[model samples]
Target chain A: EAGVAQSPRYKIIEKRQSVAFWCNPISGHATLYWYQQILGQGPKLLIQFQNNGVVDDSQLPKDRFSAERLKGVDSTLKIQPAKLEDSAVYLCASRRTSGSSYNEQFFGPGTRLTVL
Target chain B: GQQVMQIPQYQHVQEGEDFTTYCNSSTTLSNIQWYKQRPGGHPVFLIQLVKSGEVKKQKRLTFQFGEAKKNSSLHITATQTTDVGTYFCAGARGWGKLQFGAGTQVVVTP
Candidate 1:
């Protein structure tokens, strides 16, 4: 089976500019997630999607961040008017919804976003 | 707000030495999951423990969930260079959302 895939392995943008990260989950997986991993810190959940509907996004910055998972197979996370502090890795992960292996998540290589 | 903390923020040991990292939570947890992330790599799931006082092992790695369900530990025996990375313990207060510890970074020197 193929793993979760992410695009544009690396990105660089200036402050106040807009940036978007994309994620393609493993086939047959029903749950997808977006996380932000700052240097020296563990990945923090930014949003979670079960099928097409959002499950949790309490930590998401509504004013500057938005995400969507149209068709429920792929997802995109956008950060507009970015800030210097947003210069961290954006990780995408997916997991099975049924059967015995439900909670183990498979992660993508992640997109390294450097906000100048 | 809930928090998960990990200790021995960092550890450096020679090959063949044993290493252990602990994770603690302020409140009872429904489950705990472990992940290992190599430098410049994304986190990969190692294992998950849901029952209290459960002990599971994978090769040289041992994982234990405390009886209180608020603490956990990961112990690596006779560490190898392949063990270099950050080990994170994430606790779930409910379902879906996970609170991850800061992680314990391990450096193995030969």
Candidate 2:
């Protein structure tokens, strides 16, 4: 089975510029998530989507970051006026909502954003 | 809000030695999952413990959940070069909300 897929494995942008990352989760997966992983730290959940609806986004910085999953299959995360502190890897993950093996998450390669 | 914490931010172990990493959570978890991320790679799921005081093994890796369900541990036996990576523990208070720990970076030397 194919795993989660993401685009632009690496990206570079200037401070104050806008950047967007894309994610295509595994087929038939019902839950999708976006995470920001800073250097030397574990992934921090940015937002979570449950079939086109947001499940949680309390940690997301609404002033600068936004994400959407229109069809519940693919998702896009955008950051406007990117800051140097936003330089980190953005990871996408998916999980099966039901069944015996629902807890395991499949992660994508991630998009490394470097804001100069 | 829930928080998960890991100890020994970094560990350097001999190739044949055994080492253990720990995960602690501020709130009791319904389940705890472990993942491994190689340098420059994405995290891959290793295992998950759901029941309190549960222990599971995958080859040389042993995973244990504390009786209180507030902590977990990953013990690797006879560490190998292949074990070089960061191990992360994510605890979920509810079903689908996962709070991840900072992770323990392990380096094995020959």
Candidate 3:
């Protein structure tokens, strides 16, 4: 089976510039998530989407960051006026909705964003 | 809001030695999941513990959940070079959302 796919494995942008990251979840998966992993730290949940509807986004900075999963299969995370503190790897993950026993999340390669 | 914390931010072990990492959550969790991320790689699921005081093993790796369901531990025996990576513990209260710990970075030396 194919895994979650993401584009532009690496990205670099100047401060105050805008950047966007794309993610395509595993086929048939109904839940998608976006996380930010800073250096030497674990991935922080940014937003979650259950079939195109947001489940949680309390930690997201609405002033600068936004994400959407229009059709429930793919997602996009955007950051405007990027700050130097925003330099981190953005990871996308997906999970199936059927089984309740094991909630294993499959993660994508991630997009490494470097804001200069 | 819930928070998860990991101890020994970094661990350096001999190739043949054994070591353990710990995870604790401010709130009781319905389940806890562990994942491993190699250097420069994404996190991969390792195991999950749902039942309180449950213990599971995968080869030389042992996972244990506290009786209170608020903490977890990952013990690796006879560490090998392949074990070099960061181990993260994620705690979920309900479902679909996970609060991740800072993670313990492990380095094995020959």
Candidate 4:
């Protein structure tokens, strides 16, 4: 079986420009998550989707960051007018369970973004 | 909330030596998980602990969840070069969200 798939291994964009990252979780995984990992720091969860509905996204910066998991299989994260602080690896992960009772997450290779 | 704290921000161990990392949370977690992230790579899940005072092992690695469910530890016996990477502990509560620790960077010297 294939693992999680992410598009565009790496990306470089100028500040204030827009960019998008895509992710496809492992087959049969009902819970999906998006996190941002800055250099020297642990990943911070940005949003989470259970099927096609959002389970959590309180940490997401609505002013500039937005994500959608349409049809419950794949998701996309967009950052418009990207800031220098937005330069980090965007990781996609999925788990077998939809509740907080579990914590086994399978992560993708991640999309590394560099804002110039 | 800065829920998780990992001790020994960085650790350097000689080959065949033992190593350990500690993780503490501000509140009792529903569960705790451990992950290993190599340099320039994303995190990979290693193990998850749910029950209080739980202990699990995988080969030379051992993991323990505190009785209070607010702390955990990962111990590697006779470390090898393959053990090099950053080790993280994540705490989860009533939601699916995960709060990750700063992580312990382990460097195994040959």
Candidate 5:
């Protein structure tokens, strides 16, 4: 069984540029999450998807950040006109749903983005 | 807004010493989870506590959820080099969303 997969382990861009990160959760997992982890800080949940429908995205910056988990398996997070504050690691995670609850999430290696 | 806070942003201990990190939440949490992230690595789940006043142990690690369900603690006995990492506590309110603490970075001196 493979773990969560994320594309382009690292990326570099300048301010106002655009960048996208991709993630593939573990198979059979029904819940996927995208989190941002800044240096010296814990991960902050940006968006969550249950199957193909979004469950939560209140913390996501709608003006610049957007994410979609189409087909309920792979997800893409896009940052248009990236800012310097966007320099961080973007992590993707997935969890199995049981009855009405979700289990612990397994995370991907994450894409380290550096905005110059 | 729900906020989770961890005490002692950083910790340094000798190899044979014990270490502990405390987490507190502004609001009652439905559950609390612990994760460990090594330097330059992603977070890995260590354990989760769902019941009030719950205490769970794994090998040399012990996790406790407060009776009030708003606080938790992680203790490591006789710490070793392998225990080096940032320990984070996440509090979940209902489902899907998790509020994470800033984390406590542990450094063990050989």
Candidate 6:
């Protein structure tokens, strides 16, 4: 089975510029998640989608970050007017899961965004 | 707000030496998870502990959950060169959110 797929493995952008990251989840997986990982830190959850509806996005900075998963398959996270602090790896993961039980998450090679 | 902490932010161990990282939570957690990230790779889940005082093992790696579910540990027996990476312990306060620790970076020398 193919793992989660993310595009543009690396991106460099200037602060205040807009950038977008995309993710294609593993086939048959019902849950997808996006995380931001900064240097010397762990990946922080940005958003989660169960099917097409968002399950959680409390950590997403609504002022600058927005994400969508149309038709419940692929997802895209965008940061407008990106800041220096937004420089980090954007990771996307998927899992074969149900509303109840724990499932193992499979991650894609993240898109490393560098804000200058 | 919830937080997770890990001790010995970085550890350097010679091959065949044992290494352990501790994870503590500010509040009791519903579940705890462990992940390993290669130098430039995304985190991959290693194990999850849901029950207090539960212990699980995967090969040389051992995971233990504290009796109060507020702490956990990962001990790797006889570390190898392949063990070079960062280990993170994340605690879930609820179903949808997780607070992760700063992670313990491990470097193994031959």
Chain A accuracy as TM-score for every candidate = 0.98, 0.98, 0.97, 0.94, 0.96, 0.95
Alpha carbon deviation, residue A4, candidate 4 (Å): 0.4
Steric clash pairs (candidate 2): none
Pitting candidate 2 against candidate 5, the one with the higher lDDT is 2
Candidate 4 lDDT over residue span A38-99, tens digit each: 98889999999999899999899999999999999999999998999999999999987745
TM-score of each: 0.98, 0.99, 0.98, 0.96, 0.98, 0.95
Interface RMSD of each: 0.9, 0.6, 0.5, 0.9, 0.8, 1.5
Q: Can you tell me which runs of candidate 1 are displaced by over 4 Å? A: none
Tens-digit per-residue lDDT, B1-110, candidate 3: 89999998999999999999999999999999999999999999999999999999999999999999999999999999999999999998876689999999999999
Report the C-alpha displacement of residue A94, candidate 1, in angstroms. 0.6
Q: What is the C-alpha lDDT profile of model 5 across B22-107, one tens digit per residue?
A: 99999999999999999989999999899999999999999999999999999999999999999999999887578899999999
Clashing pairs in 1: none
Q: Report the C-alpha lDDT of model 1 over A41-97, residue by residue, as the tens digit.
A: 988999999999999999999999999999999999999989999999999999888
Per-candidate RMSD, Å: 0.8, 0.6, 0.9, 1.8, 1.3, 1.6
Maximum-DockQ candidate? 3
| Candidate 6 residue spans exceeding 4 A from truth | A99-101
Q: Write the per-residue lDDT of candidate 4 for residues B1-110, one digit (tens) a residue.
A: 64899998999999999988999999999989999999988899999899999999999999999999999999999999999999999998855678999899999999
Indicate whether candidate 3 or candidate 6 has the larger TM-score.
3
lDDT for model 3, please. 0.96
Candidate 4 chain B weakest ten by summed lDDT = B92-101
Which sequence of candidate numbers ranks them by DockQ, best first? 3, 2, 5, 4, 1, 6
Model 3 agreement with the true structure over A3-80: per-residue lDDT tens digits = 999998999999999999999999999999999999999999999999999999999999999999998889999999
Please compute the TM-score of chain B alone for each predicted structure, in the order given: 0.98, 0.98, 0.99, 0.97, 0.99, 0.98
Candidate 3 Cα errors over 4 Å, as ranges = A100-102
